[model samples]
Target: MLPLTRDQKHLVDQILAFTTDHVNETGPAVFTVYGDAGTGKSVILAHLFNQLQTAARTQPNSPLTQTTNYFLVNHPEILKVYREIAGQAPHLLKKDFQRPTTLINQLAKGQTTADVLVIDEAHLLLSQSDHYNNFYGDNQLRSLLTAAKVIILVFDETQVLRMKSYWTEERLERLLMPYPHQHVRLTHQFRMQASDALVTWINDFTHGHVHHLPKDIGTHYDLRIFNDAEQMRQTIVAKNNQVGLSRIVSTSGYPSTLDGGKHYITEGHFHLPWDQYNYTSTPWAELPQTIDEVGSIYTCQGFDLNYVGLILGPPLTLSPQDQLEVHLDRYTDVEAFKRRADITDKQELIAVKKQLILNAVNVLMKRGVQGLYIYAHDAHLRQFLGAK
Candidate 1:
């Protein structure tokens, strides 16, 4: 398991102690742990799960015995990586982990009860059900609350990637307002080994409070803006050789074709393909062959990397209003927008699409721990980013 910082350990203590007192109380209790990418929320959660198991061993009527433990993770890659990191706490490991859709299916079949549910990356929880999960409530959050006595939802709104997940701090509060809940804020960031200044720089640029901020240049963050993708690729590859993990992540404005040959993405002169998702249950960042393929938001979210080569594609462009905005016509990931067939309001529809792209850019921009290398596909964006 990941070593928790002092801040993380304190949060774990609060959660474990809180659960012990309120586990068997009359009704459901909700707690929302709020933290951004590098705050180490997942590790703290794992520790809480461990403490629950320990309590179960000593006390037969402990929360763990009465309420089943379920860790809801988003992806198979994340699940595989989490299980590996969770280590010896098998009862606290992936054995107890499941996806929300799986739980929704179980609930639909009348197979679910009030258990203790701990959700990681709760931002990815779908706010709407597709045709297959028609029986699922208005969203998974409703169903999760119904099925769990104690619900701990760990979320970061900036990490919301898709269109269907409408979870915000407000939405979560509205859901929890009916129940007594606790709010824990993770103040220390250990994921990137990143300094406060660097995170502020990222926050500033991604939030559009500033445009074209320069790298801090020789201190904590090794951020570089590249005029060329190949040069950035070479730098990331060399970094991966020196230390451990590095990746080339792009906005989904790049097109891909699986055709007959090896599947690849062709964007002008750049011919990188996507990594296969079904490969041997290994983390995408750990796989050696993944160096040749590009990663999307789904694959890279909730994972950290040493060197990140970011490719900003067609969707991101400096507008006529002299601001960065999502150009829906230039974007390749139109499938997400197309799914919202019921939306009749023009402005709301456009706003939703823009936010999705912005959130994608935000996530791609923040993945690096040691370094960030960026290459914007549009010359205007490159010029904008390269400037201080």
Candidate 2:
């Protein structure tokens, strides 16, 4: 279960008020919660959603009573966690939690409209039609707004990972221009135990700015650069054994395909299969056996870990000028950079691909709550990070 901070609790109350005001409005109403990864965005949504359901089901005097609501997440892994939590709550039903695509398709079939729809990972909602996912709508959020009275969503532009689902503040605002909307940005780093300086170091590094590692950085966080990949894996295993929820994750340079076969990440006699498509209810990071597999951005995003061993893959390298360089050809995730007709400029498309790669790096780095371990496939980059 997720716990809300004092500020998060207040935010929930504010969102509840926003929902109450917009419940009776004729057009679509939007309340967006903006925060970087680990600022307790999801926790606020959890509490707010629970309150909505409770007031709707148990309090006849409440305006929310008799309201039909739904909780949506585009990520299947996160959706599984929500549904599992719903199974234990008397006020929330498993059916109340669904993928955005699933809900959009259902509403398109002339199903009952939702009085309130709460969306998590709103950045993952498709901006363009994805026939593979069975979402042929022009835009998922637009379709949802048409089908729901009030929509509350959480978004972080840095978490936008695909060309199809790509979003920025400007893009989102342009879409919400016609709707009655309210938004707030949360700045605290709730997920990482590290100091602000450390967080800045991470942000800078992902942005291709390499600075010397801070001398006092290890005071609160266990930040380490490993010279050997196998040694790093061993250390992560030890961390998992001691405290649990630690896993080795990597960026997308290795050989990966949609084929139902295993591909291995081989580094200095250390070999592990890429994370398998999880068919079970458990999140990938929580499973004990996942330690033997190398996780990618897909399975590990939106989850927290006690320790993260991140392998900066081959696509990421150090330039002769000592800056970070991302080689697009080395990136194996073709689906992430798929061509979109709207993106006609070649340089703009290339820049977006590189930024998405950096975004993946940012996501993996922030997953560790207590510690972060690093191993780079590029020797110069590893040597630079390992420098005293």
Candidate 3:
């Protein structure tokens, strides 16, 4: 069973009730659930989905009898995690859940249909087609909503990580403007075990905003700043040895590639490799060797970690004015923005391009549940954070 907070449970109940009441209504019904990174938005959705599935199968004349659920998740890691939960021994959620690319192809070919659309991590939905141009004409969210009778989106606009698919809250709102929609808010931090004060402080810290920190910062939360990457890795290894689930995440200083040859990620005296490739059936975090591999935002996003050791790359460094700047050139995540490379002169794309990179960095910073350790590649940032 999926666990949910009081507010989350109530929101799930309301959404289910509203969805059941409008099972046969004309047009499409839309509702949104917004929450911070770890407010149990996906967990609630999972619980409600299981219940509805059970009702449709075992219960006679159930309101959900006509309701068919087609679950969509844009992020691959998150998609697999949900599938693992829904399918235990055989580990198959093939019929109910889908990846965006797969769904788009099926929808284009008229191979599938559903009465209700369930989307998790919907903020990762792509506004534009990918490099292969597989979904050139299909705006995913709009297409999914139009295909179903009712659509439910669990989203956090701040988590948008790619230039190809980054849709702002305003954009999503505009899309739903024509439909009657209800909004729900989730305001709890269940992923991180740290005190509320510490989570708030880390949020403020990542944004470059000021946050008053208590003198006893390390008492409740195991937050720390390390001067070197090696020490940071060792500390995380020790933490994992004790409690497990510790991992290291880094910015684009170490480029990731799929050339198929083993390549080690080396910086000065510190050396490690990128994670081994993982299929949809296996997650990198679940493997023991994953600790020796450095994870990027794409791999680590939307997942909880016992402790996080983040290596700040040059892209995230102090400007001459002492204000922090996110340098695009220093961010080696060109694979993510390769689709936008041809449109160099487009002003709007360039503006959001930087914001998307920063958003990825923000995700890694907020991933730790128990503690967050830091390792800065830039000398200035190293000194700056070490002072904290």
Candidate 4:
């Protein structure tokens, strides 16, 4: 059973009431629920799914029956789990189910004319762009809209990472303009401590604006900064032993200053080099290995853990200028063009990268339920916390 936060329960009630009222009166409509990462957005989706399933089971044989289908839309991680449950090879399932066209067609044929299409991670929907094209033309949201009477998309625009065309207010408006759309902004964060501070900081850093939350209502975790990786790892080990707190190391697969020891957990059990670019493969042995540990943050996104130890590597720096220097090479695929791009100036690129890295770090830091231990490799960056 999935646990629902108070806000999530409220959102589910709203969705159920809306669906009940509009089950008979709709050709097509879109409902968008947007929030930051680790904000219980997915829990709301899960609760809605449960409600819809119950309605389908209990309702009489009526045309207004609920035909609900849930998809996390193109998340490789979720897809792997789904394949395992179906007893199919991951590669085979990828070939069959990875393409939106194939999956949608299969869903259409198998399902009983879906009344609601719930799409998680909807921020990945590509905007109108020529340089970068979604395999399905136009937008995936539009395609899903064609198939379902009520299309519900849940995503955080701020969490978009790999898409060529970033999601913006203008782009969202344009996409839903043709249809009757209602936008629901989720402001209450039940997951993170210091929610207001984190949200305000991230919004200002990325969008050049600030939006405030009501109050910081959750538990607070200590944000510790360390200059050396060895100290950080030792601290993590000690913390685990002292408090019996579950802990895991989350890094971008880079060696710390501790004599070339890798700080981050890799994907599989194949013993690949730490510097290897590809980190996608997962062996059967590694599956259990992941389960045994305290749970690493790199793989813990879209899920929750009791405690998290985040090792912010050299790519992140909080400088004396009160500016963040984030190196994008750790998280993005644009490393190849860095050599020749007009914006080749390292300082300028570092500034941009700093903001990006800070946002990502903030998201990761907020994922813990009980505690967060931050280990900063750069001493200058450590000073920014100011005795936190």
lDDT of 1 by residue, 131-205 (tens): 554435567888777766788879988777666775668877887899878987776667665567667766666
Model 2 Cα lDDT, one tens digit per residue, 310-373: 9999999998888899999999998998778888999999998899999899999999999999
> Model 1, which residues run further than 4 Å from truth?
61-66, 110-114, 132-135, 214-218, 257-263, 320-322, 338-344
Question: Against the correct fold, how does model 4 do in TM-score?
Answer: 0.69
Q: Weakest 10 consecutive residues, lDDT, candidate 3?
A: 209-218
User: Against the unseen true structure, what C-alpha lDDT does each candidate score?
Assistant: 0.74, 0.90, 0.75, 0.53
Best by lDDT: 2
Going through the candidates in the order shown, the clash numbers are 0, 0, 1, 3
List the lowest-lDDT window of 10 residues for candidate 2.
211-220
In order, what is each prediction's RMSD in angstroms?
2.7, 1.2, 2.7, 7.6
Clashing pairs in 3: 126-165
Distance from true location, Cα of 128 in model 1, Å: 0.9
Model 2 stretches astray by more than 4 angstroms: none
> Model 1: which residue pairs collide?
none
Provide the global lDDT of candidate 1 against the true structure.
0.74
Against the true structure, candidate 2 has what lDDT?
Answer: 0.90
Q: Give per-residue CA lDDT, model 4, range 221-316, as digits (tens).
A: 444545444545556566556554345544442532324544343332312222211145452213433423323223454545455666656566
lDDT of 4 at 101: 43
Once model 3 is optimally superposed onto the true structure by TM-score, how far is the C-alpha of residue 361 displaced, in angstroms? 1.8
